[model samples]
Target chain A: MKVSAIITLKKDVLDPQGKVIHQALDGMGFENINEVRQGKYFEIDVNENDPSKAKAIVEDMCKKLLANLVIENFKIIGTQ
Target chain B: MKSSVITFPGSNCDRDMDVALKKFGFNNKMVWHDDNELPKSDLVVLPGGFSYGDYLRCGSMASKSRIMQSVIDFAKSGGLIMGICNGFQILVETGLVPGVLLRNKYLEFICKNVFVKLDNKENAYFKNINKDILEFHIAHNEGNYFCTKDQLKEIEDNNQIAIYYCNSEGKIQDQYNPNGSIKNIAGIFNKKKNVLGMMPHPERMIDQSLSGEDGSIFFKNLINNIK
Candidate 1:
């Protein structure tokens, strides 16, 4: 089974990289932007055949290593 | 005094820390990140470097290295452990310290000397230090510090702030903050004051002619504190 997860900075945390990207986009003439936030995506293939088990395993990984709870949040987006 | 400096893969400042420790009359050992056991020592250091190439966040990969278990145990047992720069990032990852280091506000890798004003002097690291302000070198892209409002309250209540970026005259202002750290926090300690995590590189300032002697004073005072 394979699972995908995305990590994003928490709402209250500042994202300077995202801000810079927004600035670059603005400079390129993409004007109507309220905000731009960046995040990370990861796909992991587990040995488990059950999709639910694989998702759980990846969720544990997210809690432990994939995301820092202090400033970032992680979500298991999909399992296949 | 006896000390140990852990050398994670890509840790560039481990040797410099070793030299600084030994120069200040400490019998320092170089410990590998993969090693499961730590040699007996009075102090342990997590030096600065691009551990694991700063993938998935600075110090995140290195914090999970095999040796960190031992380092965490040491810290829990009230042993003195200091994390400098990337080490500070690792320390926060281990939950031994509070707060997180984020990308610099300007989105740039800052490398320069800045003055840091000591906050609390009741701890072993700065208890007997003569000066309140010292110049140290900071070099990193993700050195800005952040924490939840509740964590900030707890940290302040416990007096865990170690140092603040400041002017030479010891004035801590937003303009003096080098990396946009929260309240200009350059370093902090655990509630017990044994574990210290700071973004500045004291080892880089150990020599007067080459750099400055503030690091030398820091090491000298640290050794005496341990002894």
Candidate 2:
């Protein structure tokens, strides 16, 4: 089974990289953007046959290593 | 005093720390990151460097290395463990300490000497220390520390803050903060106070001709405390 997850900075956490990118976009004439936030995406293929079980394993991975709970939140997008 | 410095794959400051430890009367040993057993020692150090190439996050991968279990055990047993620079990052990743090191606010690497004021000296790392402020070398891109409000309150309640960025005269002001760390924290200690994590590299400031001698005051005090 394959699972996908996205890790994003918490709402209150500062995203300096996103801010820099937003500034660059503004300079390139892509104005009207209210905000920009940076995140990470990961796809993992587990040996488990069940989709739910695979997603659960990936979620565990997210909680342990993929994302830092202090500043990041992880979401499981889907399992295939 | 006996000391060990764990050298991760990309740890550039391991040798420097070893030299500093030996200079201060510590019989230091270099321990590889893959080694499972930590030699008997009075102090253990995780030196500053770009460990594991900072691939996933600063100190994230190195925190999960094979040798960490022993390190954790040693810390759990109340042995002194100090993490400087990237080592501080690893300490947070391992949950041995509170908070995380975020990217620099200006998105630039900061490499220079900065003064740090001791916040609490009750811990083993700084008990009865000679100086209130020390000039130390700080070189890191992601040394800006952050934490949740609840954690901050708890850490404050426990007096876990170790040091703060300050001026040469020991003034704790925002203008002295090199990075946007919460509360201008430059170093912190675990609840037990046996484990310490700090962004500044004391080893880089040990020699007078090379940099400064404040690190000597720190190490000399630390060894005496343990003895």
Candidate 3:
């Protein structure tokens, strides 16, 4: 099973990288850009056959290692 | 007194800390991150550096290294543990201390000396220190401290805040906050005051010719406090 997780900074947390990226986008003449929030995406291949089990395992990983609850949030997209 | 400094693969400041500790009359040992057992000591330090290359998140990977379990255990047993610079990132990641260090507010890696005001004098780290303000060196990209509101309240209530970024006059204002830390916090102690984590590197300031003597004062006071 392939599990995917996405991590993003919390709303109130300051994302400096995101801010700089937004600035670069603005300089490139891309208009109508409200904001740019950079995040992390990961795809993990697990031996489990059940998608739900794989997702649960990956969610645990997020809680412990992949995501720091103080500043980042992690969501597991449906396993493939 | 005896002290141990843990050196991770990317820990560049471990030797400096070893030097500082030894200079202040401590029997200091260099402990590798892969070692399971920590040598008995009065103090253990997680020194500054780009540990684990700051991958995934700063200090995230190093927090789970082989030797960290012993470090955590030592801290739980009320042994003194101090983390400086990148070590501070690892401390927070280990949950030995509260809050996390984010990137600098301006998206820059800051490297400079800044004065810090002592918040509480009751702890072993700062007790009996003559100066209320000391100049220390700071170098890090992710030193902007952040925490939930409830955690902040708890931290404040417990007098866990150890130091604040300040000017020479010890005025803690927005202008002196180099990395946008909350309440200008430069260092904080755990609830029990046995564990300390901070962005400033006192080891870097141990010598007047090299940098400053504030760190010498800090280390001397620390070892005396332990004794």
Error of 3 at B168 (Å): 0.4
lDDT per residue for candidate 1 within B1-227, as digits (tens), equals 88999999989999999999999999999999999999998999999999999998899999999999999999999999999999999999999999999999998899999999999999999989999999999999999999999999999999999999999999999999988899999999999999999999999999889999999999999989889
> Candidate 2 has which clashing residue pairs, if any?
none
| lDDT of the candidates, in the order given | 0.95, 0.94, 0.94
lDDT of 3 by residue, B15-116 (tens): 999989999999999999999999998999999999989999999999999999999999999999999999999999999999999989987899999999
lDDT of 1 by residue, A16-79 (tens): 8899999999999999999999999999999999988899899999999999999999998998
TM-scores, all candidates, are 0.99, 0.98, 0.98
What level of docking quality does candidate 2 show?
A: high
**Cα misplacement distance, residue B48 of candidate 2 (Å):** 0.6
**Could you give candidate 2's per-residue lDDT for residues A21-79 as a string of tens digits?**
99999999999999999999999989999887898899999999999999999999998
DockQ of 2: 0.93
Which stretches of model 1 miss by more than 4 angstroms? none
lDDT by residue (A1-80, candidate 3, tens digit) is 99999999999988888989988999999878998999999999999999888999999999999999998999997788
- CAPRI quality level assigned to candidate 3 from its DockQ score: high
| Whole-model alpha-carbon lDDT for candidate 2 | 0.94
Decoy 3 TM-score against native: 0.98
Task: Give the range where candidate 3 chain B is weakest over 10 consecutive residues by summed lDDT.
Answer: B202-211
How far is B94's C-alpha from truth in model 1 (Å)? 0.7
